[model samples]
Target: MSTGFIILALITIAGAIGAMNCGRLVHCALSLVASFAGLAGIYLQLNVWFVGVAQILVYVGAVAILIVVALLVTRNAESDRQNEGSKGWIAGGSVALLVFILLAGALSNTAVTGAATLAPDSSVETIGRRMMTLYVIPLEALALLLTAALLGAVVIALGGPKPGRASK
Candidate 1:
């Protein structure tokens, strides 16, 4: 691997570890942005420009921002919540071990069928045209769905209007 790729991979791993271990929601969200940015850099280095930009825009820009906003909005609600200890660690570890074993077995059985090949033309223009002509509706629907989901999460976290409670 190139030195640049190695650097970006290290950054990605560091960011992911920071995000996973962080106790504060804001810190975790920022760490996720760092991870996404490194991933975007890797994608750009691979010449998949569309995916790279989408990674930055969608994950770093939108998702991270939404997470921070949610953290702020629910900060008070979460203050009173008790941390659940590693109650499910045994079950979680078992599931993770099973998944790892399954993946390892499957990968061990797979064989390389062909040499690696790069696409001749994977430019932004071609991707834009395809997105506009073929995948516009699905893409728009996805955007709407994500927005709805974010709003729902925020509302639920804020404990929006208890059932049968009269609103002012």
Candidate 2:
């Protein structure tokens, strides 16, 4: 409804489309960063500064960089050859239509609901405390996931066999 909301929505949609349709893997990753930044902007418009900051810091900063690094390490700068396989256009168009229908339905049925809201400072501090205390398990799991991704990247970058003639 607001100007900020309209701008953010355009940014989100454009960035998402760019990310999905970009030919270069690095360009796609950069588009993802733009999408995350737009999401953060939306959060800011909603008065959730903590969430906005966290989105920029975690997703735009760390996740985007990780994706770029992974793409580089895997040598996927160009589109994959496998993507040229048969009927890809049909499959991709079907999936896109389904997603568009779902989003349209959701938007049509949405209603604005109001509830008691916390002060941003208290909300952020509470979240931090809860994450470190009650939600420590999930945090640890996230760390483990990052560790696994790093290891996988390392393996991909280093584990390939040397090129040579095969024994007959």
Candidate 3:
């Protein structure tokens, strides 16, 4: 693995850990954004420009903002600090570790990877042309939907009661 890849991986892992352990929902969402950015950087380093740009645009930009907005609009965030460290984390951690181990073993035993594959002649221009010519409608619809959802979340969050103890 390259040094840049190693750095990106460390950032990704650290962001993931932060997201999982954060006491506040907003912090978690931001950490997730960091993780997404790190992944995007890794994609860029791999020369998969389309996927890297998509990762930044779709995940880091839209999805992360949506998550933060949703968290802001939710009642759970009001009691964020109350649930800092859950007791069930140990069980969850153990299960996650088991899954990781199993996945590692399965991947090691697979013939999925060997010689590196040469990439096709993919470029930003071709991807843009395809999106504009063939997939324009779907892309526009998705943009509209995401915009509406973001607006709705902002409205809800802005109009909600101030952060305080939940009413009995």
Candidate 4:
């Protein structure tokens, strides 16, 4: 409703689109960082300062950098291959349309049904406690997934030998 929210929404949408449609992996990662920052701005506008800070720190700082680094380490730097696989555009457009329709429906049907709200004393400590106690398993799974991705990238970048010449 506020100007800040409107600006942040625009930034988020533009950055997300740029990230999705970028030809270069590094550019996509940078656009992701922009999108994360925009989301953080929205969190701040909603008065969740801790969430905003954590979003910026975790997403823009660590995850985005890690994505760029992984792409650089595993992919050929000189290659300019765009994502032009068969049915790529159709799949992407279908997903986008589905997301738009779902979001529109959800927003139209949303109601303010909450009775209890967070107290003024609520801090990052409460969030941390809840995450550690109730969300620990999912957090651990995400960490494990990231670890596996890192290991896979390392293997792809450093473990392979060059293919031999084919015999005629």
The TM-score values for the models, in the order shown, are: 0.72, 0.67, 0.71, 0.68
lDDT of 2 at 121: 61
Clashing pairs in 2: none
Q: Candidate 4 lDDT, tens digit per residue, 9-94? A: 99998999999888887788888888999999998877788988989999989988888877877797465555577598898899
Looking at candidate 2, what is the lDDT of residue 116? 51
What's the residue-level lDDT of 70 in candidate 4? Answer: 78
TM-score, predicted candidate 1 vs. hidden true structure: 0.72
Root-mean-square deviation of every model:
4.0, 5.1, 6.4, 5.4
- Candidate 2 vs candidate 3: the TM-score winner is 3
Model 2 regions more than 4 Å off: 76-86, 106-122, 129-168
Better of 2 and 4 by lDDT: 4
Q: Give the per-residue lDDT of model 1 (tens digit) for 111-154.
A: 95866578547787887898889999998999999899889987
Which one wins on TM-score?
1
Q: Global lDDT of each model?
A: 0.85, 0.84, 0.87, 0.85
Determine the C-alpha RMSD for candidate 2 after optimal superposition of all C-alphas.
5.1
lDDT tens digits, residue span 77-110, model 2: 3444235544886899899899999999998898
Which residue segments of model 1 deviate by more than 4 Å?
77-84, 134-168
In model 4, residue pairs whose N, Cα or C atoms come closer than 3 Å (at least 3 residues apart or on different chains), thus clashing, are none
lDDT of 1 at 142: 92
